[model samples]
Target: MTPLTVEVTSSTGSDHLLPSKDPWYTAPADFEASIPGTVLRIRTVPGQPTVFSNAAAAYHILYRTTGSRYQPTWAVTSLVIPKKPCVHSGYNALLSYQMAYNTPTIDRGPSYRIFEPPLPNNYGIPPGHQQFDIMLDRGWFVTIPDFEGPRAAFGASVQAGHATLDGIRAVLSLAGHPDIPLPSSADKFKYAMWGYSGGSIASEKAAELQVQYAPELARGFVGAALGGLVSNVGSLYTVTNKTPYMGNLVLILLGVMNEYPEVDTYLRSRLKTEGPQNATAFLKGRDMDSFQAFQTYAGQDIFEYFVGGEADLEACQALRKIKMVEWMLGYHGAPEVPLFVYKAIEDELTPIADTDAHMEHYKRFNVSVLYERNTVGGHISEIVNGQDRAIKWLASVFDSSYDKEGGIKTRDVTVDIYKPPIP
Candidate 1:
């Protein structure tokens, strides 16, 4: 077995090497500002969803965040500050809400959803993410990150982790505006994370990567609430491929390919003409829904389009070399920050068994965690319906007064099986 000649691109240095002309990927004037987890550019977000729209102020933020290569790259996050102080307890406080903006188009980020409120004919902004509006109404400043990074690596952990954590840092660094006077320092804001499904991936990665990637944030982090967790990509690949949901997985793969040229190169060699045709359709910035994509390519087996069929790519050693699987694989280590993991019993994308595996792994360690198992709905249902419970748990974590009797709250993990009313 001679050493495989690994073909890698020089663009691996900084995602900036081959500019895609995306503003988020574009580096700042000061290269030093491009330091991992720092602010690159600051600007006021347009079309502020009216003051009556449950949020006080809206701003778009572009910050320097790390990607999969652990290199300097930039990403964007949307900041929504509440009108009043947090009624719960101390510090102005912050909440990083990861929106499940699952799409191949780079511009279809959470930032666009919040600001682009409904006009006469603009129905593009679905209530899919309005779920976080209650957090803003709670008097907690919320920062929604494009954790998928510049390349929009949806399922890539390191990139999501770096971008997620850096979004928080960027928001904290913002100079105080009169509407919402932010804490001058980090300690002044007690923060927590909340997300479901795709959003949960970013939240969980940020939580796990905090100690290694951003230890400074550990102090400010109170807890993390992740529902509908994505435990494994291998599992994801198994279920979504060539199925209706295959469209969703392909978008994520394109995300990885855009970042890793070698993977793209390998796939290009194996892909038939129809692959590029499908790729063009995906990047069109229109309806990127999986079911919609399913209708379009229903009987047309994508496997047949591959040079040597699906087995060839799966068997390739280079596929495992992508290195992103290391983070996406669950239970890398027990999170130092408090955790709340919940899932719908019959999640469409991530099954409860997967969530159970995660909880069991965390249980191995004596970390205090709040795990909930709801017997209602699928992945999207958990995101929408279980939000109240998730938000309540996060509030308790953020509250300085709410703690175990004079000590850190560490309890044996309790599994609750409640059937939520079907929505």
Candidate 2:
């Protein structure tokens, strides 16, 4: 196969343009003709000094990928190559670390936030940058793809899956390239994926879809580590409706609307147009970050934004479209690789029962899984508490020491640091 040609763009200063303002993000006219994963553009970028102090270089790649409707589109992935040699014995290691940038805003992706001088309003560094630093410190290359795709379709699982896989493809294709700085042995890299919360949506979908959508790359994968898995999209309405996380409904609706036209029409027709907190005004206003969503819509009921209230929002035909495998987990297929799955029993956003059912579904298909149900902490706290174990599991896989013969295994544990005084 001929190596894909790369167009290198300059990035010399602190002023980094958002995807919307940068021409480098725009897909070329002939991009549709190229195969998925074809690298269309490349640019050298500054990695977060605090996060990538051990890294040799960082670059962003604009690559061809399929969108939510299976239409040809493009996505960007940020790659960080470490200065040290491989920590895993024989092969190079690559970890696709998906960030939980749960928002409808395209500009808030990791590719933009991974640089110095974090985005305004405490967007700070991307959610998993510290974890990326840990991976880099271990001498593993990390690819942070904007798996939500060009539309920033946050809940569109299929699009996220495609973008995640293609981002890996793009990275592997750039191996040994003089300008890109990838190690020559990148082709032999053992790949693993790690994600939590919204990030888990992409990692889980990519693991399931790899056998069908990108079968050629299946054998290269060691396994995937998913935490805080959202097993069913339909459950979100009941779980998050009037809670502090109620804003998730707005984000999911806006995101899915970008991918499904029917959903857009359905939501627009029903959205209240007169009030300060009306759905129409909120959706049409400035690009929204997840922080803004949480602050603005916290404790508000999502049903109130519609015409007939909860009944209308629930009865809409468009709801059925998103309930498919593309949005719902475990409906499409089982993961082909061994999985290290963990979740908090008290997860406020996603129901533990849904994850329980999801595990049962995968086990029935004979997929190798090591599931851990943490007795303490909720969705947010689990990210910090469960990460040490998750990373250890990933290390075992990359080093070819993980036991694939071990079938489904489940464990219940407590991961909280807080303890009550002796009774």
Which residue pairs clash within candidate 1?
Answer: none
lDDT of the candidates, in the order given? 0.64, 0.82
Model 2 whole-model lDDT (C-alpha atoms): 0.82
lDDT for model 1, please.
0.64
For all candidates, the clash counts are 0, 0
In candidate 1, what are the lDDT values of residues 1-423, reduced to their tens digit?
A: 100111111122212211144343465576444456566555455545463356766666677787777777788887776777574544776889887666555656666645554322121222543565677767888888878766667657678877888888877665343333466556678888887777787788788888787888777788888878777655666555565556565656566666667777777676655754444543442334343454554444455646677775675565675534533444445677877777767766666676676666666665567767766666655655566778888888777644522212323222333344433
Q: All candidates' TM-scores?
A: 0.81, 0.93
Give the distance in Å from residue 265's predicted Cα in candidate 1 to where it truly belongs: 0.8
Per-residue lDDT tens digits of candidate 2, residues 98-121?
A: 988887878888898776544443
| lDDT, residue 60, model 2 | 85
Model 1: CA > 4 A from native: 1-25, 30-34, 118-126, 175-180, 274-302, 323-327, 401-423
